[model samples]
Target: MAQRNRTAQGVLAALLAGTVALTACSPPTSASGSANSGGSTKALTVWLQQKPDTASALLSGTYGNSEILSVTQDQLVSVAADGTLEPRAATKWNLSADAKSLTLNLADQKWSDGSPFTADDVVFTLNLYTNPAVKSPLTTVLKPIAGYDEVASGAAKELSGVKKVDDHTVRIDLKNPDVGFMYTLFGATIYVLQKAALSKEDPATVASSQIWITPGKVPGLGPFTLSSYVPGQRAEFAKNPNFRKPVEFDRMVQTLVTQDVATQQLSSGEMDVALVAPTDVATVQGMQSKGVGTVSNEVPGFDRYTVNQRKEYLKEPKVRQGLLTAIDRVGIIKSVYAGQAKPINSSFTSSKVVKDGFATYDYSPTKAKQLLTEAGWDFNREFVIREVNNNAQRQAIDQVVLKNLQDVGVKATIKPVDQAQVTDMLTKGDYDIFLYGGGNYTADPSTNIPMITCANAFPKGANLPAYCDSKVDDLLSQAATSTDEAKRGQLLTQAGKLENADVSHLWIAQPTRVYAFSSKVTGGVRGGDGMFNMLMSVQDWKVK
Candidate 1:
């Protein structure tokens, strides 16, 4: 995981005082004790902020859903804490010199049902994802492969790019060279499913079938297997006896809990681990210092306010720059996050290779006023900033932003809407500015730069800003195909610099993901994207 020192000293007393009434009950016994008590199974209890939408691993698109899927399914490759690729189902892989094809050697493993895992399973899994009937979000990752579009369009039954060489090997042919394709294989969206289970089902409806949605029905090659599931409530997992490595916990319980009360539940020992909200960081840190638990923080993602470039006033580069320079990002971090976050100058804030390479926009109210005046802003027009109401941090930050804009003689108002409505509003280009948060799935710039590219603009894609520059697009394309790491980093650095100069999106602060876990939990339970799966190494976790 990326490392950074915590700068703020948490005010635990004041923060915990508000939660006293909420956590009045006695602490529950640790899951470790239950296992040691000679029960039929040992379990570790975890609390999630929200319930997952689906139990099928491949169909899950949200981070919360990915967390549950990680424990129950194994990808062809796994990402190490330091972002290095490690073999999982595929023991090793060989890429062609031109980078147009890859050959994977399967591991000597078996599915949860003791069925042999073969290259055919890998081919079937990729084809299923690329099938238009399935309409999985993961299809984007495989779309670059040769003949993938044909298969996805229903013109072909199987991807011509994917071929099973034998029982232990498979070859994937790509339409173009993609340096980041190897990393894409490690994502939770791609998983090998037993072909036998889906042979008779319609690919479109497989996600809702009992065999896929019901726990213990779908065969997995993970260290843990789903034992039971309750929608919007909890899910239970048991150690897979056929796993290559010994699993420390015999059972794991995932419970649904709201973010506001997660810290209280953790403090009361109802959960062994819980993702603490930024508002409860101080209390959780205080608990950590008192030996109740430990808190791990990292730059897991970034939050930004995207300026709608399609707007007539925003079309001018100067106006966009003025709006961005007017905001006090540092002040917002200090006031809203209590210094829990760091100000970011670029959208790729979490990327160590490109963040520093981008240009910085220091807080300059005078410069902002000048630029706005030059762009012909009358200072009488009121702009609406749309934000999701559920995000307490963003709501607080928005208030600060409103004051900053007012100070500069620019009129603005905060329009709070349902979290579900924000996306539709953005897509419809109904807001002048929209607040959003996202993280790069992989370490490469190719994973994130596309969001602001012209191709992803509203009505067509996720580029809410509708910002696009041919120069930046060229740089991104060059970076995506480059095999040399240093050259690729240089190209991406150039792209970041271009995007920063364009001022399409006002980069705010990179939020730290705080994970509070009981001291009893030990092992390599760290790394990867903090927001997705903090327990990526749960197989190594041993409760004392």
Candidate 2:
């Protein structure tokens, strides 16, 4: 997932200084040499901020890895540009009459090594993910599978819910009917791994072994094969000859280029595609005017501040609501984001999945003061708002929040901490408040709403606020298992209202994703969870 960081501003400033010199260099030649050079473009070059930790999709959650892994591995399903579920390895699927089980007809496909892609591979992938030895973040997504607890507890070696009906078919029995189950299959967290290649080794070792990280050694069933990888540097991929469809580029290269340097490279034609930061949207737009192609969309995530309810001073709901009311989210969007973000007022931002009956907390310092007075909160104590040091946007928003709270007779200070420390601080209740943002991975509220649920309260889960509510938990649980869309939406709306009333999170804005590519590169699609799915349609990409 793309993290909003303050370093982007510094990166932009540093890169701007050398933009003239970098652009002064000769324009980069096409992958297929220049028309005058009598060579054909055979490769596409892309810029990523960081190198992936591992090529195995199940082991890593970084978007840097997904850019390469999306082409190198095939998922059971694929998410379309509009966020609809589409078949990939699984050609077609049918839900049981009761909706508690799903049967999928696997495509007649072969791994990059020519081994048959069978139902065994799918079963193995599921079992491997559910294995207690492997601490995969994806374990949560597969928890709905029947017998998942036994499998995760090491009491069972295989998941009873997953069975191979035939060589080309697999059935998954869910403990409860989940409408978002298909979406889970299409997520970057789940991808098929060859059973034959991995079954011999301890499942835990496979994720860390060179056999999985090594470019040519990793078995994949996608349109490309990893040719080479250099940590924190670059990765190279060659087209898979056994791919079901034709791929336009013969090879793809992903180079690690910071946000500051990416725009300069894109403008100078040194890079084919790069994600443009919100601060750099204007610069990229200027490049677009000069024929630089661009793709923009709303990613499935939102920026917000989490109020730590565990704090004595913030234990009152009125204090949380007062703070929320005091902050000017719209003004922050305009000043910090430069009007590049959409104001959000609830936990669920997507209208396609959840309805919009959430309570709104518009900016009003007078109302905030009134609430504080009623709550009997003293205006003398200095509250600390911890923000990650790398995110310039959050830092700007922090300053704005500081000023807003001060105006409401509350003394607040901004505490800048390392990005890595924010989570620990939140988990330990070391901070009164913090600013954070990232995707829920899936559009369904069940995937993200749990963050504020009692079960996920701090130390054990991501409920940074240490918030607990039985009604909210019940609403989310009902929303997850109900097959009725209207009923589910109603449940989610109720859940959102309960959380907003508790002020678990002060909903801010939904940031826009912007990507810049050279005119020669075609077929870019922005899909689920930020830019994780940007290269999901790489097979259709062509360079003219």
Candidate 3:
């Protein structure tokens, strides 16, 4: 059981950054790493951002329809462009007699491996996460549910959070009520997994293991199957033949391609369907009615900056607040993202779909300077250091904040690094102010908020900023143990305000995820109310 090397893991993930390289034509890779089926001809073609550990972002819902699955596995929920949650997945749900349990009645379903779907699957999945040996990032997301750790630790006889009485019926027991529970449940963490398949791998490695998910062996209950994985070459998937639901396309082929190549191939009609970004919409859209494809863009999750509170300079509340007031979120959305994103009002996206009543940062240089001065910085003092990437957005933001800090005579230095180095400093707690994004919440605030307590199941606490608040800890503990949703939300709201004011994080804007598709392609896209998770019921999707 060798630990995964941090450096290696970061590098592997960073490789996904170069999506433009994949747009070109190249011979598919050898079968040494491919999971393609034996002589299966039925499939579809999707040009993906990069190769994935399990399924590509297109399959996972992190992209568009794939992003939806992360919110809730049930197909009934939809995310509005404003980043709110709508109904999908479970048709109806209920809380228990003591208000500690939530029971759900699912819409129709089946596993991609053709196994009959059942509540036993849900129970098994949750129980697996509770296992200390499992070591999934998802464990922290499930913290709001009661008795998860107990069952995982084998201290409790059964999982108190989720119980299965029969197929299509799932009951979730919470230690307390959570206001944001439903929103958090919409993401991929809750998607079903097969017990028969999971038993094959080492639990800790399950996060990145490929045996159960290879093209020849995936049991996922998603719309498509892994058809081919030719590393540094191509990845292709086709509709599930045994899929309980009907798919539109007979065959789909995906290449290990990027935005640049895909756009070129698509523009030339070499690629049939693709996601054209907003910046390039002119090229794709210029042909609207004349071209073979259509374009779409929508606001999604809020991407923000994180100050590793575990670091020294950011420990001062004023310094953190200073950074927040220093940048113009509106300019970043308009200039860097080209108006595709909306400046966030609260750390929660400005989208009304979520209805979050949390503290928000109102851009104020005066307030930031006052806070910095209160933290004991004279006009001659140099107290802040910034670690950013070597990108236009990072450089632009650094410049803005640096200029503002100098206005108050507090010297701030910005350091840019390759993504690999950034990852190292972020997780290892080595930076004063690091740019980090991901407070995109949907069902429950548990996964999005980054709160922590002594009872937390995660080896590391949530405040990647690494800040600790006893009151916040108490709230998280009460929320985790309580089955009451109302009380859970109350605690979360209280905690959110405290953290927001402390400025451990500078909440930014809700980014838009826009994609262009061929006129021939028809299916799900981004949501209107909540953040669109792309785990869509795309089996019925087809190309004309």
Candidate 4:
């Protein structure tokens, strides 16, 4: 594959030549670490249509949950909806002896400022996101722990895959043998962050990620404790009296939903939940025809276009399967998500390589001009794609897929770019296709097999089609270090028959994670996976 796009363009020109001051890759935010809305505690208002500038102190640095106010949800480790792994703040863990390694133990943690959740706060958030001056997005999901690539390339300063076997035990160690390494340590980027509550002052709040956009102290142990988050109003999260309250909810009000006017703010009792859209599920079936609320829909996730094989007519795999037979993934999931999406046949959904009854695309602009005239990629020239900012419904689904690729003659357009220039134009292979969306968290393929086999598909993973195939990267490095669930389900069924017969993603449509709650506020559908799994323990959440 042109030596895999010249080794992912020379490891993304050496990780963007370690971007020594181009001054804009942004990401240093929390907008003043929040909490504090309805005075003396007990709130759970919640509503987030995704803005809090996308909060990610890497889920409170490893396993601390809520970031650090004396950890709770009974010490955080919950992941259910049938994928198992329950017990937050950890009251269990200890695997090794050829099972790879794990060890944890914690029990009744603490740290929302009182300290003592130890192993030096998980080796200080694994030496602060394997620090290169904390350039963390959990450094591409903790770059396969086990000496996190020599402490993220600075040739180890610590973190021989985190060790500390004492102060509340710790032992992680797994550069291989990851049959879902306890389901990727039930993600939230494995939470844990503390090292003396972010070194209590001077430049070293994890060395200035401006201590999350200049907010003061965001340390948590979950049961909500945030004090202020006003970016379009409301983020409050009280009741962390060093938590340990179940049936959960002590207080966790999120509220920031910038309207999709689904109408029933948790059934008109003034905000309890929201995310109805499919043009508001017929205003939530007329708020379930006035009896109140409950709307369950499940498809879960997929909405791709990531065709930057390294630009230019998408480095032709028949122009990325001729823009996946020029979209219409079921007429844009039946008129732009009016049915709230579904089509995707493979990228190996819910693993065991999902193929029940295959054969997907059928929108045919005469079979997308006969697969761009059998791979020569024809007159159809519509190319300018980069928009992700102010996503007016992905600019109205790129103005209806650019009038259906200008009615087959092609020549499309959409340069939107903002949200930090869509994460450095999809990690600097600049962009010729990026319309993205791919959250399947842990339902497998280690999340859609890293969106199709492609070994870190160059330029630091998410393989933007600099797609290589050393036998599908030795069967995706033996399905990521093997835990042998039937030999990692026959190597993810040969990496889903080499990712849906190599259509190399244009799959689009699996979607349904819509969330909205407020029927006198009570938490039930509570997240374990997909459809916000009821916002994964939105903490002691209440209103009625």
Candidate 5:
């Protein structure tokens, strides 16, 4: 999945200056030519910020783990470089007239071990991921499917909605209509596991086993197969002979290194691909000017502070609106991101709703004070804004926002906490507010609109604010099931307006995610947000 928040502590000045030596330990450079076969000598060296904790086929909960696991697996559908749906394992698909069922036509392909790829594999994947014992994030997103609740709650071990129509076709029945259900299958987070190889183990407990990391144990359908993985140090992959797509490179070598070290390695040509941090954007642009490599910038999501509506002072809409209005968003963008970001109001950035007039929450101290006073503001109470303690950039920005709130007669201060504490606070709703970010990976409005629904709040769903409004919920429900595009747009626009009016969250700026790639690499596609989607076309990437 495209991550919502990517907060990390900034590196020391000594590290950024490259005075303190750190090694990526990249593999020996190969000849400068393309490799057509697995034995051919062409190779690519990639750098990741950290080592993946787990490479389980069931859970891709962390950052670097998703990319490592995704390259070795194939899903039913993949998002193209142009942000449109493209067929991968499945050749094509059709939704029923009522939009309650979906049918997929599988391609004539084979796993790495030469087993035939059929509808049975798809059905197995659905049942495995939905099993409550597996504790996969897919359990929540796939809830729209028929019998998903039963499977997710441990009431049933198998998903009754998924069925194999034939050797090459599969049918999925949904309990209710969902127009954007296909978008949920974006290959970044979800993947099809080999049923022939994995069916022997308990689906609930297989993720903890070493089956995925062991070479040749888990037969993959991707262009490359895992050759070796050394936990925190490095991982290597070789071309898969049974893959349906063309493989341009003989092998891939992934090295785990920090962001500061990655920038240094890319500049020295030790690494072929590395993600560039916002603080090092100028340095990479300088490298680009010197013909070292290229930099790609994308805005796939926005940052914000999720408010807990259960708080007495925060329960009122005016108070929440006032808090957002007082913040100097433009100033923060300039100081924090160096003018690389733009102030965003709505989470649905790609939709017409944002451009057509969603609330901007423009900085207005006077208006903010008036709104706060009208809402019976509690002057004696101090608001604690919780965030990751190690993030220097976030703390600097939060300090500015805190000052803005204090200037408007609001008592507020920043409380820095670790990642574990942040998670606890969000789950228990134990804090006044917390910093976070998120955005939909697909173009459909249903992917985002349903996130704030009442049913999705806290214990029931992942809604951070725990907000509920019957009007907003109905609008989103109608939009998701509507067949008319115009009607869907109208309904979504109305829902966004209501959500913004209620000030469900204090919206912030949309940061531009940057990455550095060596000039010798070509055919690379920049997918949105995280590394998983960004490297979806690794099979087509070539070394000159």
Candidate 6:
């Protein structure tokens, strides 16, 4: 295996050197002609691992949605490459001393169709998000907003807390003090839609409405405008003429393809940017030695398996705990990730947030058997691993887990479903267990820790495990509302330790995700953080 890895690394280096040589020798201008801006036109092609259901952030939570929207839509605030909050549509935001209210000063901006963007857009978007019919995952994040419950329960048409002070300013009143509100109003997730164009459609159906789904019908306050979309294939975008800032690339395309295909395309110079699978880390690193492309692999991204507590046999905490101990995460990481990952004892990535008393589930076949027997686990029942077909690394990891389960006298099998059907399966509780892998959207624990709370259960938020503990929920709530940073950290640490003991979710390994950007593409952020932040400055990226 080591010999094959070395050979693969060698081949990857040669391919990258050859691709860079070709790019360096090519003509500057395309055969078509110069752009309307009188500059050499450059087009960027990006490969997304999954096909998105819609470009609208309100309607979709797919992996590809954020990448497209990061460039095609504008939010109130954006996180800078250095992890500081920067102004986008809204120039600045100020939180009241009591932390019960937030006032936002809007920037003088126009939508892509030349319509004015105002505080009304902000109010409308916030109220629309609370509409029960929308089924947005953000409802949990925005729960602290005053009047949210009334709007969510269908008792109110508009959120009374969101007031449009004037054309250029808005204020939001909260039911309780929440210091993490800014991060909750994250850039990639909270896009400001134009009220004039979208208010005509019903809030419930707007996400699926033709006006919003159609590429150019609804205008956006972004650097790029959606020009065309081909389901399961690609989405094309053009530079927004009405954008306030100058854009370097005239056009950009996001194509849906598997990770392997993306790697192949990158090596052949057919693709400019794409994610690298864990198994292919060595290959990409070899390519990076030639300096034709940049490889970024950052922490806080994880791979976990969610236990469907709704299942009768899986409800017992011991069963869940036993399942965790049976699999050797360290061995799997070495085998699947080539020692590029670390085993996570709790949901937190930072040691400071992980309480000293946090529970640990070390690999022990004897202990796993004892726990299962004590919980009266059924050995004959099949342990099905529900996962989609898009990620090859996940499939390889699950196979090892299945073998571990079988070794512990458990019958297990992997059920591969189509990527399109994953949402439905998760919503309907159709699986015994499933693989959940992704990065925390922000460094703030409040943004992700609530995912396991009861309020975030499936059909509303991302709590697919359906593991509810009142103590943990209270700690998270207190942490979210506290204005003191130290207090919040302490509360979150307590919650993490409690949930870890309960085995809410089988916390596995924290992965180092690898992404490759072509040498010609400049100004693209590293993929160490969420993918949204990676392309936050897509408009500034230029081809050499």
Lowest-sum lDDT 10-residue window in model 2: 5-14
lDDT of 5 by residue, 345-393 (tens): 7655545454466677899999999999999998888888876644455
In candidate 5, how many Å is residue 52 off? 2.3
Per-residue lDDT of candidate 4, residues 1-544 (tens digit): 0000001111221111111111112121121223333344344454444433324443222111122222222223544433346676677887665656778787665755555666777677666756655554334445556887776678877777778888877887777776555543453224555667665543223433434422336566665556555554445555666554543445555454444432444565455555555666666666654445554645333456666666545556665666676777787777777777778745555645647545566777878867776777646555776665444555566677767766666676777665444445666666666664433333455644333445456444445556545576678677767666787777767766766656676766765645555555554544321222345555545445
* TM-score of candidate 1 versus the correct structure, residues matched by position: 0.83
Clashes of 2: 9
Candidate 1 clash pair list: none
lDDT of each: 0.65, 0.67, 0.49, 0.51, 0.67, 0.67
Stretches of candidate 3 above 4 Å error? 1-45, 54-91, 152-160, 272-278, 292-300, 350-370, 377-424, 442-447, 450-462, 471-496, 522-524, 527-532, 535-537, 540-542
Q: Clashing residue pairs, candidate 2? A: 5-391, 5-392, 6-390, 6-391, 6-392, 7-390, 31-41, 32-40, 32-41
Compared with the true structure, the alpha-carbon lDDT of candidate 2 equals 0.67
Q: Is candidate 4 or candidate 6 better by lDDT?
A: 6
Q: Report how far off residue 149 is in candidate 1 (Å).
A: 3.2
Which tens-of-lDDT digit does each residue in 209-270 have in candidate 1? 55654775688888888776666566667789897778876877766655655677677666
Error at 294, model 1, angstroms: 2.2
Better of 2 and 4 by lDDT: 2
lDDT of 4 at 192: 56
List TM-scores for all candidates, in order.
0.83, 0.84, 0.76, 0.34, 0.86, 0.87
Q: What C-alpha lDDT, on a 0 to 100 scale, does residue 394 get in candidate 5? A: 60
